[model samples]
Target: MKKVLAILLAACMVVALFACGGKTDPTPSADPTPTAATTPGGEEKPTPGPTTDGVPLGKILEGDHAGREKYKIVYMCNTLAWAWNAAIADTLGKLGEPLNYEFTAWAANNDFDAYLNNIPAFANQGYQGFVLGIDDTLAQASMEACLEAGVSFVAESTTIMDKDGLCIWSSVQQAQVKNGGIAVQWLYDHWKDYWTDATLDGQKVGLIGLNYSAVSGINERKPGVEQKFAELFPDGKFFDGDLAALGTTGFSAEGGNQLSTQIYSQNPDIEKWFVVAYVDDWAIGATRAAEQQNITDKTLVVSIQADAFLAEMSNNYTGNVYVAACAVSSTEFAIDMANYLVATISGVATPETIWPEWNDAGGSYPRIQVEGTMITRDTYKDYLAKQAAMLP
Candidate 1:
């Protein structure tokens, strides 16, 4: 009996061992909860924070590491109140913060003396850079002052003369002469039928110029037109006889109106009147003159610089008034100049140059040439759409 009892005790021990082993190795629970690994103190290890392309947000948010310094530049225009002023200002502001620079603008409002006088004021006020859209007659003096003051200056819209290394101007637009050629071409192409008769070949075309007293660009456009007309129609004579009527007035709508009336009265039978002025203010005055004289159908009106009146003329002035404008991307050019000036001040070796070559395209200068868009009654809508897309 003792031996049998001992056997039973051994069997019971084996069964208890099997039961403990089964409990230890049982299948994982159907709804198991995952427990993260922890440190010796029972604190969970931190998961790596989210990253941008493997770079941590904290690191990416840091400021520019290139160590570029900020610069201050001053831009001077013929006038700040002009429509193009807003464009230049907008571009400069857009380029300022990104490139770490500032652009301050000063305007002379088409006053040659005022422009010349403002140079010292800007220099005294800590302006180190300048972009000049100055009167041509005064450009020599203005540029000399800029160089004397040690201010790095760039010229836009207007050309400046220098003796090789002494003067530098980065022209943003094609020469005013080229723009004048464009106007002349448009007139020849569209109005050739009007002057088709034998007597009209040598007929005179009058020019009404604004601020010819000081502004060279204004004067330059007149000659450009004459030269281009001579090239296209060698027999056509400009500013002679009935066509020789040329007048100058202030740069204002009222001035344009007053001048237009005088021109109409002086030469009523003048076949064509080319107003070398901005499309809106001057064109408006010309339209008013045509309306008052009841000669809207007989005269051909052309203008430069597209504006609200030009847009309206594109749609309405089909037979009466013809408009041609030299369209410029002033905003984009301003932005580019701002960037270049900042880069230059920051020690970038790149030099800025004019858009169109002063001579033939042999030399090296960074120039961006923008062409004017021609608008007629048929294409007014298309022009409007394009103009709208450029906004903002």
Candidate 2:
């Protein structure tokens, strides 16, 4: 009861699971990159192409909603090719059955233009509400369109300009950021066990980010990693510290593999790697690249957005290279969003009442933050059990 927003968003809450600590650099050490990694058996590695086909979007959701309350809702997914987006879209598609809302989902295919185009199309079709997994580039347009159409919309995991009618819901940005730092700490905690070295002064690290284009939610995570690195090893360095080239086409396994290969070729001495991708594909790609370079044992790989499938893969992977991952369950997040949407449509909640940031008197937007689960090989089973227990 601390605030109206907290009371309304009881289901869409954020829970911080860990804190970060740091140690100063005791000695001025040399650069971390000691040597470059070579391809297996000293063979030349193939040059990676621009596109590595990522996971296909799962089957589309279709069924008869013959007798439902006929609340046509369109859920605009960020991209269907990514597993997380697909999971969310698919979950919302099915929610219409029990939730009494007609659902239709469309994939933006990671295209900003396409994302923009989808908005008016849905509005023209007379869709009542939109559940948008927003991209930073085009949120204002979408919000304006929804406003003009007199349609209610909520943003999932991303925000648009603060407007009166819109509500933004996401897992806590710090949750993702903290996981970034946690990945770094994972290596530090286990560094002695792997290297038998007393200190971790000159270890080079590699990073693969979704993109460097100032996407609000994703960009903050890189600093979280950097902050942790600086804390643990004062002046600890990344491969090149070049922010511009650190991004990828999309968070795909192909992009991950290609980027990892590129990083391996460019800075083979990187002893550890941190990846904050759009999805789990980057983790899979990096691990594959590490194995091919025959440096799986030497490198520590940590990532975020490990979906259920990839978490299972973490259990099966041979070594600890796929170190730690945070699972932001897209399906669960979608469910919570659906509940909010249902409440809003039923006249039970409004932006000003539920979102702390929304000002009833000030005419502002609403924002909700949710929590995610972290998974390691050891903790995966527990996560699975908790998820299963939720099933009817």
Highest-scoring model, TM-score? 2
How many clashing pairs per prediction, in order? 6, 2
For model 1, what is the alpha-carbon lDDT of residue 274?
54
Model 1 TM: 0.63
Residue 123 CA error for candidate 1 (Å)? 4.9
User: Compared with the true structure, what per-residue lDDT tens digits does model 1 show for residues 1-392?
Assistant: 99999999999998764443221111100001111112212233342232222211111112351466556677777665445554565556554565565666666555678787778777787776677766656767888888788776666666565555333454444335555667768876777555444244345555454324344555555666667767876654353211112333345555566667776678755655655454335656666676777766555666555553444554465445545454444443564456445444443423433222222234444333334445555555565554434323
lDDT of 2 by residue, 132-165 (tens): 7777566677777666776667776665644554
- Pairs that collide in candidate 1 are 171-354, 204-243, 239-244, 240-244, 327-372, 355-367
Model 1 scores a C-alpha lDDT of: 0.51
RMSD (Cα, Å) for all candidates, in order, is 29.9, 18.2
